[model samples]
Target: MPFIAPWTGENVPSPAAMATRLGRAGYGIGYADEYGIADRVRGALWVRVPVKPGAGGPLLGRIHALRQRQAMTHMLCQGCGQPTVGGRADQRHLFLTASATGRPVAEGEKTVSPPSCAGCALEAVQEGLPSGRRYVAVLVEHAVVWGVAGIVYSPHTLAPVLRDVGNEFTLVAYDDPRLPWTLACREVVALHGCTAVDLRDLSERTPA
Candidate 1:
């Protein structure tokens, strides 16, 4: 099934489970020094799962779970978890969407979502997903590995510090020195050559 988040979908919570003293990759709920990411530094924006923990666990979405898996393993499609890239420039993966129809997708667009095969991209458009209508296709011409979105912990205590007033964690880039100490969940990729295509139009041109 398509990744349907609870916020936009039914009353379903996240389909993941992780419990520790400190949050890991911003997905679970924990306390001070519990989440051990890596060697951390002070003053850096890290991306993480924002959890206000209710009864069971923090309310996480399916997309969040899928993203974590994608980060660890490269060459996987953000759309279907299938192998998209074939280790060549022309064989690079795609980040399909419908946000920019008839327009060119600019570079430097950060995407936590995974890559997609051409067939899956087309199917998503035809089948339709949560925000599928406006999300046009996005081809990742150049996907340079960026840092992750995680939480920034206290240098001494190792507890996640709230940078923003109410925000749980922040976006941490891989270039930051404190990257090792942050719990990364989503795998972020810089999108290039985002080509917006209209499926209906393409279908007409095809011989099939």
Candidate 2:
């Protein structure tokens, strides 16, 4: 796929445009940090550019460049510090999938890409099991209290952990009518409670 600059508002750029930009700017294209969805649910791409010997690029540009090249940026597992690869590459193992029904449950279609390495993916899968537990618990608690169903986690609270731990969870929601305040509360609690469990044993064992 050809690269399109988000800043330019180009939805999709042709190969010629991409090559033109690359030649002019000497930028190498791969995948950007902002391209993919968490846990590989959606595909993403990163671009790398070599700055001129002494020509300093904008801070954002430099940061983006560095991020594109980071090992973790491309399926390097944060837990075991290993490159997730082969059949062991299960991105869903690292991301949590939200329940479709109002009742909280575990399991979902694996829409995301797995890690690039086995060891890293194993640790991620272990951790995701606990995360799924917490996620379901929070959802059930919210439903019992407020009688609403949907993704109940704030991105602000969830993003940090999601980014740190890995994208093993995908929040989903129902279209049933419910109070906005109740829905908000569910999301807040879900985000906060998911990470409030015993960190030491979360990945050591499955939730009872």
Candidate 3:
């Protein structure tokens, strides 16, 4: 199973679970039973979800918050949940992402998608691209935890800010003031020293 896949047993948490919690940073959203460091990422509050893997079939395109965070924090492959860099401490990790312009992955690009191992990179490139869009692969020398993608709550009203009609998530950096009021769903990382890889060559080494 994919590391970030959401199982059927993992239901979405209701908005009623959120309440205003005042701290040194000011008013932020928190659960009634929220723990200090455990419930936060980089001082930003994260959404809580139950851990139940293999409860049912994989829910494609949906993410389980905790699993996503785990894969990202440990640099595990989104495909097989194994170490993406393996034991090569000096080797760069591989990251794949969709590109509308068909350009190569660039340095300092922030992405919510975690790194993929060589075996899964080929599968992703073969099956993950949308109609007309291309996918790009890059070997990243550094993948730094930058921020998160989550719901931003109002500091005053303590309600979620519906920025647009359908946009429920917003990217907020660690240093951004709005982070304090946000409930993170996925961890975002910035890729540095990226070198684009050709999928044709990558497929050659993929296991049969």
Global lDDT scores for all candidate models: 0.49, 0.25, 0.83
lDDT of 3 by residue, 1-208 (tens): 6788898888775754778888778777888888888898688898878788888777887888988898899999898899866534457888888777879877798999899888788887777666778888888889999999999988778778887675558999998999888889999999999888887778635322
Model 2 misplaced stretches (Cα beyond 4 Å): 1-46, 49-74, 84-92, 96-201, 205-208
Instruction: Identify the superior model by lDDT, candidate 1 or candidate 3.
Output: 3
Best by lDDT: 3
Clashes of each: 27, 25, 0
The weakest ten consecutive residues by lDDT in model 2 span 180-189
Give, for candidate 3, the lowest lDDT window spanning 10 residues.
199-208
Q: Which candidate's TM-score is highest? A: 3
- Candidate 1 differs from the real structure by a C-alpha RMSD in angstroms, to one decimal, of 8.3
Ranking by TM-score: 3, 1, 2
Global CA lDDT computed for model 2: 0.25
Better of 1 and 2 by TM-score: 1
Which tens-of-lDDT digit does each residue in 1-208 have in candidate 1?
Answer: 3331222323335422322333223333333333334212222222334332132332343555333444325666544555665733466455654443435556787766666666656666676655423555554567776766666656566566667775444556766655645555455667766555555644412211
TM-score of decoy 3: 0.90
lDDT of 3: 0.83
**Residue range 9-125, candidate 2, lDDT tens digits:** 222233211111121213222222322232121111122233232233223211222222232234333233355332222222232232333243332321122122333333443
**Candidate 2 structure, TM-score to reference:** 0.20
